[model samples]
Target: MFAPGQEQLSKEQIKAGEIQASQTVRSAVAGAIMLYLSPFAVDFVKKFL
Candidate 1:
């Protein structure tokens, strides 16, 4: 779906974007997992207090 002569992304460019997106998504999921489990971690610390 190109107009007269519009160029699409090259495979390398697309792959780079995909890798960057995946890395960002991975970090976000990791952060969410950490946040989800943080209360459990705090429980241990609370036991000493």
Candidate 2:
């Protein structure tokens, strides 16, 4: 009883949601990495130069 177009629309919505979630996670991970590295980088610069 499912309409053909409706099914496709739902699938597209699910795919979009997954893509958005992945992008958000990627951004959060990148921020965390930068936060973790910044102090080390500053110390390295001070120590070496």
The TM-score obtained by model 2 is 0.72
Write down the lDDT of every candidate, Cα atoms only: 0.95, 0.91
Q: List the residue pairs that clash in candidate 1.
A: none
Give the best candidate by lDDT. Answer: 1
Off-target runs (Cα >4 Å) in candidate 1 are 1-5
lDDT for model 2 comes to 0.91
Instruction: List model 2 lDDT by residue over 2-35, tens digit each.
Output: 7655534577888999999999999999999999
On TM-score, the candidate that comes out on top is 1
Cα RMSD, model 2: 5.3
List runs of model 2 lying over 4 Å from the truth: 1-9
The TM-score values for the models, in the order shown, are 0.76, 0.72
